[model samples]
Structures are given as C-alpha cells and as structure tokens.
Target: MNLLKKVTALLLSLAIVIGSIFVGTKTNSYAATSKSYIKELKIGKTYYYNLDGGKYKDKIKVYVSKNDNLLLRINDKTIKVLKYDYEYSKHNYNRLPYKCNVRIYNFNKKDKSLEIVLNYREDLQEGYRILKFKNSKCLLDKIYNDSYMEKYDSNTGAITLSEGNWGLFKDFTDAIGRFGCYYKIQIKGYKIYNPYTSNTTEDARKFKYTADKNLNAYTNTNSSKIAFTVKRDEKVNIYSFYQKGNKKYIKVKNSSGKYGYIKIGSSPLFEEWLMVR
Candidate 1:
C-alpha cells in the first residue's frame, strides 16, 4: 500500500517528462500550457512576488483563493499560480479544493525560462503539474512532477496519498478553466530525452534501495529483535540471516551497516526499485 503511494508520487514528479519520457515510438506531445498577454521584462534583473493560480492554468490569479501561494515572480510582478483549496472544472474526484503546488526555480541561461514542477493532492490522493516561463508569461504545456506530491497529512499523522493512482486529471486540455489530468504540464524550450537510459550493468547493479513496500524482517526465531524493515523501500542492504520453522529471515542493513532482521519473502522484486548505481 505504501508502495502505491511512493510510485504514484514518483509518477507525479515524472509528470512533466510525459511527452519526452513516455511517448516511446509515438509522437510525443506536450503537457498543459497557458497563454496570456506577454509580460515584458528588462534585461539583467530578477523579481519576486507571491503566485496565485485559478481553475486549471490560464485565468486571473488575483481575486481568487490565496491560501497556497508558493511565490512566482517574473520581472516585476508575481506569477499567481499554485493555489490550495482551488476549484477545478474538469476534475471529478472525492476531495474538494485539491491541494496543489508548483515552484519555479533554476533559471536556465540557455532556455531563458524558469524550471517548474507541481505536486497536487486531495486528502491522500495524488496529482501534479508543471509550468514554463516564456521570458514573459506562464503557460501550462506539460504536467509531470512526482517530487512535489510527497506531503504528510498531519491530521492523520501519516504520509498522505500513501497509496493510489492519483488519476487526478485524466482529461486535461488547453481549454481555459478545464483540464483533463492533474499531471498536465506546460513547457517551453526544454530538453527532451529518453527517461530510461540503457545500461548493460543495470540488471547486475545492487546498492541502497528505497522501501517500495511495507515490510518487516525480524532477527531470531523468537523474533525478539527486529532486524530491519523495507518500509517505503528506503535504500537498504540485504544483509545476512537464517531461517525459522522453514521460513527464512533476512538481516537488513542500512547504508551505515546498522543491521536488523525481517522475513525473507517480502514484497516481490518488481515492487521494489532495485537500487541501481
């Protein structure tokens, strides 16, 4: 279950790379995009201001819910996007006022547009977004950024969206105030590449791995001491161990070699992201 949350969060981060990452043999299209009267700027300067987004991507940021303003400044005015308790036109989910955020950073001299990423959620459900500045205004072209979806539901005292498809915006379009999926992305002058790199040593690689699934491996037959747990698959080492009652136990070691124990048969290898160097 936790694995679902981790994977969904990951998928949301990679959301912006959708066209460039997943198109495979097909023609990769762009993510969510927005267009407004271009905001002119002066050379050799930077600006900062709070961001306010409305509906999907394109719409007035001012005079709207200003709860979750992550701050986006272009030139002199703040780019109001990334709104919490925001309403959607095309989204039909179980939660209301979906919690979403998009932060702009890493100014690229080559492209001249700010790098943007988003993470959206409803309670624990997942979603994400991406944006690119065109030296003037913001536009939603692509959507994919799993990094932002990692939020903790303080009320529940657990990782929010810890498990689910995060099928937030399954029907995003360029239409104003209407988006299909929350992973909707918008980019301008971005490098596209194969998300996966071909490496002959991949299969043979082994190192620290994140706990993709919830697991507990104990120490002795009495199980008095807990060896380690692969919870959330936080990179670990398959240390050493023995068996009890025809059942095998695995000694778990952290990157520091601190060890623990758990059952040998945990989540399948497919569920765990094989720590690759």
Candidate 2:
C-alpha cells in the first residue's frame, strides 16, 4: 500500500510539471504575437518622415486613425488620404499608393521610405461645376492663387473645384459678403458644402437676398407685367437666376410668400440696390 501511494504521488507531480510547461509555452507564444502586432501598427500616432535625407521632409506630418485612415497636413492644410488604383510596393503594405488630391504619396514598410508623386491637376468626377468667374478680380484671381487650380473635364463639360474652393465659395457667398464689385454666376444643378463639414448635401436651391432699394418683380424675363413689388430693406429668397442682354434676373420669394423675379447687375454700385445674404 505504501509503494502504491508513493507511485501515485510521483505520477501526479509529473503531470503537474507537464501542464505547467504547456501553459508557459502558450503564454509566451501569445505574448510574442501581441508584441509583434503592436510594433506593426501604431494607430492614432503622428509619424514624421525623416528617414530619407531630403530637405523640408519634416514639414509634412502624417497621422493614421484607429480605422486605419491616413491624413496629411501640409502648408496649414489638412488632406485626407484616399485609396487609389496604383501599384506601390512588393508587399503592398496597407496599399502604399494613396492619393491626397493632386499629390500621391506611397509608403513602404520594409525600408520605411516615403515616395511623393505630384500631378498638375486633380482627377475630376462627373457633374462638377467649373466656375468661370465673370470679370471679378477676387473670384478670377482665386483660380491662380489657389494651391490647385480647378480642372475642366472636356468630356463632362464640368470643372473640378478643389476642397479649398468649396470653402471659399461658401464663405464668400453666405458668410462674408463679396465687396467692391458684386460676383454674379449662373447657378447650376445643386450646391454642395465642404465634404469635411457635412455629409449631406444642402438644399441650396434658394439663397437669401436683401433688397437695398424697392424694386418691381417682373412676371417674366421679357414681360412688362409686374407680379409683385419688393420693398427696400426687405429680405427675399432667390430660387433661380439668368442672364439677359447685359442684365441678370433672379427669381425670388418674399417674406409674404409672394414669388417674383428681380434684376441684378455687375455694376460697382450694384450691392447698394441688392445684396446676397
């Protein structure tokens, strides 16, 4: 009986030793895997490109979000990285060739190198409105002063406005009023906001306008009949507009729910008669 008890105790000890060895091996393996994954991905961290011996390399700051979305900040402008169709690396780590507007930057994990490719113009999608500013210096000069000039798509007959242009147009027309000479342009399909600000498109069909002086609303572009009379300092909402023989006409609705057409112009004193609100 004594010998059998001793043998049983020895077997139990051996079994406990084996179980510990297996558990230790599994724990170590798991720990190693976790460490490697942490090293591979550093989400929400800003990374600098100082690996290459290039001037002005540190000027660009890149950040990757928790969702693996990359963003770049250059010249005080933040550009979001977009997926593009281009081969970058042999391993294609996170799909290297990423597009940021007119420039494409590729990242390689193996050598930790960044490659920047620049293009003169951006690739425009269909149905983008190309603004041909009519004789206004501020609006016209924006085309050249901007980082990337709007591109005209010959096939679509539209111009691709940059993200900066969207903000500029919105601020000029809605917030800060255009000065010196009034800006006049033919409204197209629909108006869009800054993509970063709002995901939904604005019901921009009607833009607010204030009457500087009392004016008569015409029944039609060519008709002598009057539909209504807009009072001075009265506010109206513009629904549509058109150009006719050196004059521009806007279809508007007054606070009284009365709809009529008002004429607008490009004269220096045009804002005194009517201004966009």
Candidate 3:
C-alpha cells in the first residue's frame, strides 16, 4: 500500500508539471498568432493580412516603405499599391509611393485639441470613404474633401480606404477587383500638435554624394528596371532612402539631372559604394 501511494503521488506530480508545460505552450502560441494592424507597421518588416474584413480568404503579404508605399504579394503575383493622395508628385507616372501634406490648424476654438487635416491636390479618390479606426475598432468620423481644410483632429487613428467606384483595379495592374483590396494606412512617427514640415524642393544639393563605382540606377526600388546608370566617381543627389525586403535603395539624381534609385548595399555596406559629401 505504501509503495502504491508513493507511485500515485509521483504520477500526480508529473501530470501537474506536464499540464503547466502544456498551458505555457498554448499561451505562447496564442500570443504569437495575435494579428497586428497597420498602425504597427515598421520599415523592412513584412505583415500578413487578409482583405475586406477577411471576406477574401487569401492571405496577403504586405511590404511598406518609409514613405508608406505598399507592395502586396497575393496569388503568386506582386502588386504595387500607392496612396490615394499624390498631388505633390510631378514627374513620376507610376506612383507607387503616395505623398500627402499633413497640417494642424487651430481653426476651431471650441475643441481643446488642434484640428489636423490631410491635404490632397488630386481628385482620384474624391468620393472614397475614409474609414477611421482607434485601437483597431472602427470610428464614425467625417473626412472633408479640400486641398487645405481642417479634417482630422489630433488623435492616433488608423485610416483605411473603403471600396468605392474608384477601385484599386484602376491603379493596380493585376485586376484587383476580385480581391476586394482596400488600403490600410495610418499616420505614425509624426508629432501631433507640432510644427512638422518636409522640404519638397527638387534641389538635390542638400544630400549630394558621388558614386564610388559604376552603378545601375533603377526607375523604381526594384533593381530590375534600370532607368539610368552612374559612372564611377559621378556626383549624384540623394533624395531619400527606401527599403524593399532586405535590400536598401537611395532615390538619387545622376549627373544627367534625372531621378532614379541606386541599390545601396545591405547593413554594414549600405554606403560602401558611395562617397558621402
């Protein structure tokens, strides 16, 4: 009887230990599977998401750049998604990366916070409904259509584009009508109620540099499409840095005064082929 009792106690203890381990593993798996929205978007990171409230069952892989340009890989094809607002872009026809001007106005004195507005010069997304969300929950808000008008308030919210008459099929070449594609974008990394401004001047003299070797400059971030080439020790003006997957590219203007992207090496060798000015 004593031996049996001891065996029973040992078995119970082992079961408890195993149960704890099982519970821990389950918890970790659940935590890992928790989906993150666009607000958590980071450069050089890929996000897995579904479209139209999961109405489309296909899992899409999204890649974002510092400028909020999105690349979606679905059904074994890559699609370029640009922002609805692209008034500032002058020369670029294939507008992958979207640009918008964000400004704060103290127009309404009744409200404690300053009024935030997004200015768009283009009429491409005129009637499109802007779905605003707070903490991943949808919020009923009004978005005014004006070049310079008070639209949003100083609040951290996710702005998503809902399906309208002007669908992504017009912009994307893959005929995105079947996928119910909607853009999930948010304003982040910008200080609210602060005077923030981005210089849009075509002056490349600000961040000028010289190529250490003969490098091929592409029209887009993908090194496949060579727009131009920079000879060794040729001077170029770098506008900004963009990331596509693990590769980095600098938007630069070669000596010919044409804008293009040059592949800057990854990590430690990012500036290996460039002589910084």
Please give the TM-score that candidate 1 achieves against the real structure.
Answer: 0.28
Stretches off by above 4 angstroms in model 1 are 1-98, 107-112, 135-140, 145-188, 191-277
Between which residue pairs do clashes occur in model 2?
Answer: none
Give the alpha carbon lDDT tens digit for every residue of 118-183 in model 1. 555555344445455543466543543321222322222221111121232111111101111111
Give every collision pair in model 3: none
| Cα-based lDDT at residue 137, candidate 3 | 30
Q: Write the per-residue lDDT of candidate 3 for residues 94-179, one digit (tens) a residue.
A: 65343443323333223222222333334343322232222223332334331111122224433333222133222211111111
Evaluated at residue 204, the lDDT of candidate 1 is 15
Q: What is the TM-score of each candidate against the true structure?
A: 0.28, 0.30, 0.28
lDDT of each prediction vs. the true structure?
Answer: 0.36, 0.35, 0.36
Estimate the lDDT of model 2: 0.35
Q: List the candidates ranked by TM-score, beginning with the highest.
A: 2, 3, 1
State in Å the error of residue 151, model 3.
15
Q: lDDT at 22 for candidate 2?
A: 28
Residues 1-277, model 2: lDDT tens digits: 2676446534533433343222212122122211111112122344444323334443344454445544444433445342222223213555433333222222223333233322222322111112111111111111211122223222222323222212323232222122111112221222212211111001222223445567889987777789999876566655544444454566667899887766655432122222222
